[model samples]
Target chain A: MIVAKDVSLTYQDGTQALKDVNLRIKAGEIIYITGPSGSGKTSLLKLILGMEYPTEGHLRVMGQSMVKDEEDNIRKLRRKIGPVFQEFKLIRGRTAFENIVLGMRFLDFTPKEIIENSYMALERVGLKHKRDSLVDKLSWGESQRVAIARAIARKPSLILADEPTGNLDLDNALNIMDILTSLRDENTTVIITTHATHLIEDKEEGTFIRIQEGRLKMERRGVEAYE
Target chain B: MNKRAYNLAYFLKESKTLFKIDFLSNIFSIISIGLILFILSLVLLGWRVSSYVIQIVEREGEINVYYDLSLQEKDINYLMEDIEKIEGVSSTSLVSQDEAYNRMAEILGKEAGILELFDENPFTPFIEVKIHIEEVDSILDELESMLGIDYIRDNKNIIDRLQNILIILKVLGVLALVAIGVSTLIVVSHIIRQGIYNNRDQINTLELLGAPDIFIGFPFILEGVFLTLLGGVIAFILLKLVLGLGYSKFFTALPFLPLPAEESLLIPIGIFILLLSGLLGIIGSLFGLAKDNEKA
Candidate 1:
């Protein structure tokens, strides 16, 4: 649920990250943005996350503008986003369950719901056995699963996974991809950016967007492809 | 608000974790805050005791009126009635020469042997007029105009000195209160800032998760309040002990000083310190949070 029109982002040092990008993404659509390193994939994600404002043109995520003055509204918009960061950003000194539950603590969820959803997400990520383990003590793969569980526990309408398959074995990366893809439903859209294009080369559905040198090329599948 | 209520335990636990992040520093902060509050409590106690003494002295306002030595008993009786009827006078009574000599002997205590040098009772009988301190000038003027009154000896100098001491005590009390408030605020705010710095990673993660500022900052605020409250309790206990020990020694050493009962002074000062600690804790934490937010 994002819309961008002629959006261009240039950093303070005048390095242009994106140039005149225009795209429209509908709800409940899974998007795989495939690009090489420093190919504006993360920059696009940053724009969508409201971490940076566009230098030119307008961008909207979940009906809220990505502008400097609309920071409060953007924050509200972020509440509906489940972001799996590249580094997994799991808080140290906390158990996996605690980390997951913390994501939903400030949302509109009862204590019981938060705990239940946390457990359910942990089960989906195959981390239920490690739920009591401290995040810092967990292995890299285990910590990534916990981070995914934390993102999914909030039942966010939009999920953005940045480089989820980075540095993972094929089996673990496939499992992670399966968990992220299965989360998409009639009401939830998942957008994933990855440098590893081999993970989803033969997907029969969803949208595939390719970016290179601050430009975009989109390819759709299923009934949208026929249209 | 309801979500915050549900997560109350989480916030408190987070606060505990934050406090323990720098355990030694936090402990030191509590001790310093406690000692500062103890100093404030002592100043307040001094102010209270001094004010009590001044009040007792003011309420015992008196003037000694010496009459004509040749006045007969009936004339003296008439003069007493006239003095009692004065607008500001509470009561009047005659002190005989023997009673005056006895009073001096009691005042001199162990040095009463010097009075043996006198061949007769050297003291003169006078009318002791008790009047309201506020009406001193008017009462003295009235007495000076009366006939058969040879001299009026008022304890105005002592009363003035007592009032001056009370004024000084009040000024010192106010100064101490302001200084303590500022110092507590600074210490608490610095502690909160340090905690925020230590937990900056968690804070950043929460911020990216769309958590409200209140949710993210609540733990730091709780840590601040808990530390200050603990400090306040420590100060209260120390103050109670000091008061207990000081009261016993003061009554033994300077029993003539008018001191309020221990509870009368301790209860109110204890309550005030606790309240001030709580108030300063919240304000200082908020200030720290605001400044941190500005930096962010």
Candidate 2:
């Protein structure tokens, strides 16, 4: 769950990253935050991830205030949430398999259990054969799969993906969407931010909040009818 | 998640990865420390040998007390017994006038030929006194009372000067050891800090992964320790090899080098230095890490 009530952020260099905004998302909900460049999309994701604090108002994620006790609660909240970066952010030194299993290091899984779950996650992303391949050696599409596998490997309740399919072809992008939608079916919350207009066709009856110029546009009812 | 087990496994895995990533750097740091340790060990070996030689020479060069030729044989025997009763007189041998002349003749063989030229023995009767060298200073005033009556002569001034020189040499040796140790630490620390500067990103990543400070800092410390141990062992071996080859030729004349005891103590002393080097390495790495972390 997340709640941002009238939150605003301004950079030190006098740029308004996020305007005063009110937003809420319930547990087990898949939401898409769509906006143009500099529309505060990444800022909103960072605020939600507790990577940055709001300048004006409160922001809460998973029932913990993201601003006041960021250091203490960020790690705890992160344990239950998987964040996939736009650039993948996989460690260059680690192989695809090792990258996928990094999240599980904090968990007390046996070595065998770790191997099994990691293999399963890689298999889900169709990257099991490239398990031992280094991240530097991975093609863009293959690295994207590895990032997704890492995000979901620990069975985190919430997954925040920032342009998860940015570098992928249409077919690979659709497969990524299918994988995310499948996670939603299992009651895992998946939130993604992207400018890819084709995602509207596969909206799947969920909320689509669009923003422009640091302000939210009208919520369209064309996709999935909200309860 | 079980935090304890998780942290343990993470530390083990991270340390392993770190070692693999920067094996060459670690080796370089260790070798730098090792060279410093080797130099320090050489100084110690030299000091030990010097002191041992000084001690031997001092023991052999104690004061000689000559007896009055006018004293009767019974009186000279009583005087010898009285001198032996002194606290620092370890042993005193009574040398008759004839024995002194014989000793001088042996020394001045073929050169002076004074013993044959003189009609009577020119040497005075003397007591060959080898005092317990350490206690020689305290009993000097008591022995001076025997001047010109029971003893005709004494060489306390010469013994005093010799002891003073040995003391000065011992102090200089200790000062040299301290200087070498401090300099070794500085040089090793500088090398390790430079290595840390080169691979700072690796350290940052480990910190981000929630590694405890010791886990992050230990490799550099161990690097120092390994180098110190290796250098120390090599130094000990070198010292022994050199000493062994020259034991009979050079060191037999110099009794200051405690032959078996000091030789056996080398390993233990080297181990102590190895531990110290490791500690220095850790400190150096931590200092660099702290500065980098602050900048970050």
Candidate 3:
């Protein structure tokens, strides 16, 4: 769950990334955030991830305050979050399975659970067969899938994907979207940011928000979308 | 892993990876740390030896008082009885000139060859007094006032000199320990920082994945400890060999020198260095990790 009230973010160089943003996100809902390049999409994700703080206004994610001083607690709260970056931040020289397992190693999972969840996540991302391939050697799409697997392996309640479909062909991008959107199952909230507006036009369910400069331009709720 | 639990095997594997990442550089750090620690060991050995000599001097509580050679044998016997009558004197014995020369030869050991330069015995007879160390001041006071006294050789003077040497050795040992501590800390921390930079991406990824600082930093800590521990072992072995060689030579050159047994001296110092090395490694790694955190 996320709550933002009149949030504004200005960088050190005085670049206004977000302005007076207010939104409420519920658990177990799939959210599609569409925005153009440099439209503050990643900045919002960074705030939720505690990598940045809002210059004004208040924000909370999963009952943890998203402030500068609460960084340590925010980090603990992040354990319940699964984030997929635009660039898959998988460690080089490690196999896809190793990357997935590494992400779950520090979570509250037993050794057996770690192993089982990793294999299951890989299966879900349709990369179970590529589990042995080193991350550096994997193709872009396969690497992205491994990143998604790593994120989902720990069964976090919230999943935030920043441009998962970037720089990919239509087929691969759609495949990634399918995997990420499907990750929003029971008891999981999935928020994805992307510039690929054309792809979201086909989605029949889930909540959608469009960001134009630093402000939200529109909000659309399809069937079965949250209140 | 459970929320508060950690996998030791995983941490060790990560440590191995970190250590292997810059194996050549780590080897150099270990060698430098070892040599520094070896210097400290030598200073510590000097401290121990000087302290032991002082202890032996205090325990023997013995001094030699020379009498006028012009006095007749009857007068020397009366002087001995007078020394015995002193309140603090435990006992006294007359050491003959020949006996004094022979004792010097035995004390010199291999260096006794120097005494052969003399055609005649270059030694004097003296009254050896065994007094309680606590009663030494009163006894020396009494002997200095006695008649026919030529020169009184107080062992307390030697004890004072030995004490000075002990103080000097102690100061040197402390300085050496501080130097080794500071250098090892700097080297280990710098190396750990390099490791962090090399794996910054992975560290960032781990941080984002909600890994606790301990989980992220434990491998680095292990890496530092491994380097210093290796250094400590090297220092211990090299010190052992050097002490072995030095002890044999010292006994040959100055057989009367009081030294603690080799094992008693080495085992404690060996344990101390190894423990200190491990402790320094841990502190250094923590410092490195904390600095990185500040940067982030």
On lDDT, the candidate that comes out on top is 1
Q: Which stretches of candidate 3 lie over 4 Å from their true place?
A: B1-6, B69-77, B110-122
Could you give candidate 2's per-residue lDDT for residues A48-74 as a string of tens digits? 877678889888888888774566556
Q: Against the true structure, what is model 1's DockQ?
A: 0.54
User: For model 2, how does the per-residue alpha-carbon lDDT over B179-289 read when each residue is reduced to its tens digit?
Assistant: 656665665555546646655755543333333456556655555444455555555566556556676566554543445454554665566666656565455545655
Q: Who is ahead in DockQ, 2 or 3?
A: 3
Report lDDT per candidate.
Answer: 0.90, 0.69, 0.89
Candidate 1 local lDDT, B20-63, one digit each (tens): 89899999999998999999998888888878877888888899
True contacts kept of 3: 0.63
Summarize candidate 3's per-residue lDDT along A137-180 as a digit string, tens digits. Answer: 99988988999999889899999999998888999999889888
Candidate 2: CAPRI quality band = acceptable
User: Where does candidate 1 chain B have its weakest 10-residue lDDT segment?
Assistant: B249-258
Candidate 2, after superposition: displacement of residue B200 in Å? 6.1
TM-score for candidate 2, residues paired by index: 0.76
Model 2 chain B weakest lDDT span, ten residues long? B204-213
Which predicted model would earn the best DockQ? Answer: 3
